[model samples]
Target: MITDDKDFEAKSIIARMQRIDKWPLPPSFLAIIALGYFFTFYDVTDIGFAMPSIAPQFHLTGSESLFLALSIGLIGYVIGSFIIGYLADRYGRYPMLILTMILMALGSFGDAASVNLDMLIVFRFITGLGLGADLNLIPAYIGEFAPAEKRGHLAQITFFLGILGQAVTPFVALAIVPPFYYGWRVLFLIGGLIAVIAVVLRAELPRSPRWLIGHDQIKKADDVVSKFENYLKSNGETLPELKTDDINKINVQTETTRLSFLYLWQKPYRLRMLVFGLWWGLWYIGNYAFLGDAATILSDSGISLASSILFLAIGAIGYPIGAISSWAISDKFERKYIIFVGSILWLIGMLIFGSKANSIALIVGSFIASYSLAFLIGIAYMYTSESYPTRARTSGFAMGDGLGHIGGAIGALFLPLWVAEIGFFGGFAFIGITTLIAGIILVVGGSIATRQQLETISA
Candidate 1:
């Protein structure tokens, strides 16, 4: 475990990083960060492909069954995010990350061994709890460790891997889901294996030196910096000494001690809280609810499973691509603008898709909606990451993400019901209107509020 005390001059975090050493890879930091994230994400998305098959096996009513899989786990995620996010600040990011991975892996294995719906939901909830921790912690961990120039680029990996996992679902299902008695179980096992491998790879990764110093573990921070410099040397880079002025910045004075969940509601931060939580929730209202309920929606319109999954995958492909683009440009645009554009695209696509559900045009339009939603999600993650001070980033994102998960939970309840009562077209229209309202709210008032912006302005 990396400790938080060692001797050296205090200096700015970014300046220390630049001087430590550069890797041969173009942003070697991103490569390591991306790999860690891939495992975490593969767990989240690997279940989507199984949704269609699993719903029937469990005798799920359209929304009820989907919610069983989605809402239950999401609820657990909300709880875990709140708990683990606060702990990340208390215990240290790397320690929390490793523990979360273990929990997620255990949950996956447990799910694989379950016998019935009750048992399945329980294990899924457990899996979700660990996943929730990953969702809150990983982005904050990445953002803090990265240089400002590439923060968005690095942060985007989480979103990109999430989509990548979604993209691979079809293949994973085709190969591993069913025909064998243990198909569903196989999905959980796969996630566990990936997580274990990621754990091994991350052994060399260090804690955020900034976080250590912030907590007054100056010696431990120095040791981390020294190890990182040595690692860079092995990669053919030179070590730079930490400057006193930079250290002073990293150790900025703050009275806040235990990062309480209540901090999310304090003034100035509260407005930020409202923006992130509401926007995230609304984004899901448009995305997952639509996607989770998609198979049933298409089937009602007389589409085949083959066509449905293909279009869904195509829609998903847009996520990573759009995420990568946003990651590259996020620093350049105000967070509000990126989210606004994505929501607009979502509204437009959903409206067009709902109106033309019976036509091939709707399929094309639905795909567009999917792409825009992915772009919006990528932007949302970046914005959430940028919304809080480093000390509270995970907690802020967790609360906001929890709000988003609620949207998913709501979609799990309402989408199928709406489709049943008013038809799939009407259902899409309803969500479209809601999502558009979410966009309007942000456009009217949302702005970047994270400490990163403060640093930039001061610089």
Candidate 2:
């Protein structure tokens, strides 16, 4: 009788934890995290806009020098993603998140104050560390908190909002850079300020209940779950009563096992990891090749710098549009199919952009390409976040995303050389061909995960 009573109690607690899906979306939490993501996008995309002004000041005239200057940050991304992601899994999510925000703010300030190319590269590397951590951590945080039914929508929404920060960069650059060439420094300063603000806002948010459970912090997890239930009650929602046998079943199965990287490579997970790694690597190669050098690409094709910025700003509209489209269809469609189709669209767009130097083609092609990339990113975030168990989720995402950064770094380094050697048409053709190959791999190997709980998907 006593054994039966204890089992029932444990099951009830577990059921309550799972019932977090019934709570209202916490606006306060989402808003604060979204703010951090905003600064991340702002800091990253601002560099592309600032590069033209920076190149003249530092006497960096060669394509190789410019590519190196731009891509040096990605080296830091690899380090931070691998190390910090492991730490987040070991320590806790909230602390690591706060630390990343502080690092980002400091790095942004350092970049704004840099006096030379070497100084700028060092600071950009530091900023990349924070950005990499954000990329790995934010999605995990969102995934753990969101309900299965709405998980894709919530994650995609946050990602799209971050892209809004990217969209805003060109307009801010155009407003600041031409009149005062030194205005690029001010952009970094503003980004730093935003990070500081996000830190303050995020301080109020709670740690992940799912993470607490994975770590054997049962009492703390229960407390957090109760808070979520209370929040729902305050919103006038009723709680469902759980059966004692259901609770007992959950209790019997509950065990805290330390998940390591080796575990991720075991049966069922290895194939998923491969698909994720390939998708991330291939997608970013094309994405960075185009956006990282938008201004330069346009200027090389005979457009004035001023006109190029305007075109980019116009093309930036696609970011939000793509984000919205992804949000609408994320829950409705299988993620693997969305990714496959988006990749194909991106390939087509790149081909058009590379086909001719006509201004109309450049503007339209860039828009389509940018839109398709953002759409793919939205779905990718949803898929990756849900693909791993809570214990190893951030680590899995970081490893795969780190691979993507490697590709982005390579693209940044070599795409310019490709352009110099074979012209814009050849450069974009390279992007198109690579993207098509990636899409084919995804179609062949990727798993479909739609409207399923994270635990169920991982299992």
Candidate 3:
């Protein structure tokens, strides 16, 4: 049905874009972004490991105090995500990313130096703000730069690295917390140092070309793309002549529309936003409720604190494994289907773990649950960012993820109460049911987003 000129134009654009993908800069680019995310995860997960030690020092014996300590950061996360997402879209990705890194560094040090519970909570909230912004921005930045064919894989790779930061936290805690007892402060200090290093390294990275084009910075976008083309030429790859028409097409599509928060509530974007928000919120409620309190839950079930940490460390191995699985399968299957299957697996795992709180069941079920959660995370980041156009991509992801933090915060608040009131089985049952509901929602409403161009998907 297409005319010859139109067909030629499509092919030309595809060819030009394909060359950009083949450029050699992606691995290093991904590495820099991944390193930044690594510290974010490290800082967040370290708090869980530190809490057992922190409770005694701060007299945080009551469930209310513990919940306040745990959930306050998520409150900051929600606020920062919404605000930074808008700023990233309006100002730029790189600048906001750098700013967050600085905030994280300062906040981590502040957390390290806290003399009272109030100070600790304030610092944790500040750190959470940076974490929330980074979470929303990193995926958006990567999604904008990566080729459609490899976008899912690259995004998962960064997420995988970040999970590794989390996976190692238990070991780090075991190594430091017991021997020194005061070593919890040292953990925050290390996180601060690493964050400072990431900021320095990330400064060398370039801004997103897709973002540039979306903002009507056509000349800047062209220059960035040209640098990639030149790199390919220097590396001995043959490339087609640059197509002016293809460039114009991108500019035309992206330039006319100015994105706002209200835009997400209209037309096709509304449904997608609703789906993404539900998916993110439900997953966070179940996953954070379980994993965030894994050690405490196990300890309550008669396991020794040391033994629980060991069990948690063993279970944490599933994060990287599941991420690797997501990496391999991401582009091959529809992301919605992947998320649906992961939710089912999570439910099944929670049921198995909840049915019995013995060491063996806890270890095995935790692994399964952790693995399934990782699969969802790897794909969710890609799906959320890609579901919207470049102009609104950061804001869209921020809104969904920010709203999702409410579920996580509430779960953090209530999971301990649930454990105290019922038992481990009852707590797991609650999360399993939540996971099943999420799976059903996805099955009924999720969209397919496999190896599709962001613009085409958004359109």
Candidate 4:
């Protein structure tokens, strides 16, 4: 918790840093981060398409085996994320990001070469670790660097670019997965290649100055912040004046720790983590329940394989569109409110998809569900990242979201059985209902942080 002792001296670099409202870095720098994130979406999304081909070879005809395969990566994700988050907090964001890409590449390439389902599952665990770490650190990393006013806007843009992976991967899968027995392997190869490339690209990203401050590398932190200040001066743009009163109100946010995720258990941080964790876990439960089997469900319900891919591909357009919408509005309103609206919209869309098996309904409902679900995601990320101080942010998020992933695993595990009992309509409706509950919990329990500096809000 913050206290008077934690306050910085006059001429505080953080106070000076907070005075700027625009990004100090070059606009193009966000590209590589988004590019690295693209692989994550592709790896998660391509599984549904690849499963049809995979099942025949692996003999996963039973629902139990299918669901187990679907849920294993997520189980791995939980473990990997928590470990990586702690490491990132203790080490540094830039180094951890590179490590995450390496792990993902290893997992992807390993999956491509797997001789059996067991081999595939083992490799997938490796992949999940990378994914979990990426998801935890990226939002916190972004929030740490972003000007308070545009934090949400910049994150939404990065996600919008990253989300194109979901938008583009189906077409890639359509071309590869159906024509050959080993076509799915090619998809994995592509994901691996992207990860290798991201390593080189993301090497260019600067470390989070906030993270440096949290670790007591104050001189390094100032040097990093000074780059942005110097950049503004070079452009013939004056830096905003830091007021004495505003500076007095500002407290340097930090805590010294060694492998101490225990900091999260303290009072308001504990409560905040609970709310964010549940929201993260529950949202994934709904998405994994439907998304992992969406194509299969459609195929069984009489939609042709080709048509199912087409519908999914088209509907996937919603990911970027929804991201654009988030970019436009996330900075303007409290993020929890956006999450609430998204849940309602997702519920309506899921209902439409489950109501019947018609083509038009499939197209429209998937579109709505795609974008609305994206709403719960990126906005919730912003909310989660903003809730904690720099020292515990990534690890705290890791523990919270990692445990929440159990809900995802459970949803994927039981979904096939549940669908057998009540069918697709009932399955999707259940997801929608659970989503609504999570949304309500988030809005009621999460902090109100619109337009607030991360230090001020977390304090």
Counting clashing residue pairs in each candidate, in order, gives 14, 1, 0, 0
Candidate 3 on 325-354: residue-level lDDT in tens? Answer: 988999898888888888888988888888
TM-score of each: 0.85, 0.93, 0.93, 0.96
lDDT of each: 0.67, 0.79, 0.79, 0.83
Q: Output the lDDT of residue 96, model 1.
A: 82
lDDT of 1 by residue, 1-459 (tens): 312332234244435664532331335455555655665556656566556666677776645566787678778888888888888877778888877777787888887777767887898898888888887787777766655655665566656765676566645655666455567678778878877766666565678766776566666766776676666677777665666666555434221658546766786678877877777787677666776667556755677655665665555556566667666667677667777787778777777777764555565666667667666766666667666665677778888886678887787668878877897678888888778788777777576533253244212
Candidate 2 lDDT by residue in tens digits, 276-389: 788788877877777788687777668777788877777777888888898898888888888888888888888888876577787778788878877887678668867877
After the best TM-score superposition of candidate 4, give how far the Cα of residue 211 lies from its true spot, in angstroms.
1.1
Question: Best candidate, TM-score-wise?
Answer: 4
Query: Per-residue lDDT tens digits of candidate 4, residues 55-114?
Result: 888887888788767888899889888888888888889899999999999999998998
Off by over 4 Å in 1: 1-15, 18-29, 174-182, 229-251, 355-363, 449-459
Residue 130 in candidate 2, Cα distance off native in Å: 0.6
**If both were scored by TM-score, which would come out higher, candidate 2 or candidate 3?**
2
Candidate 4 segments exceeding 4 Å error: 1-11
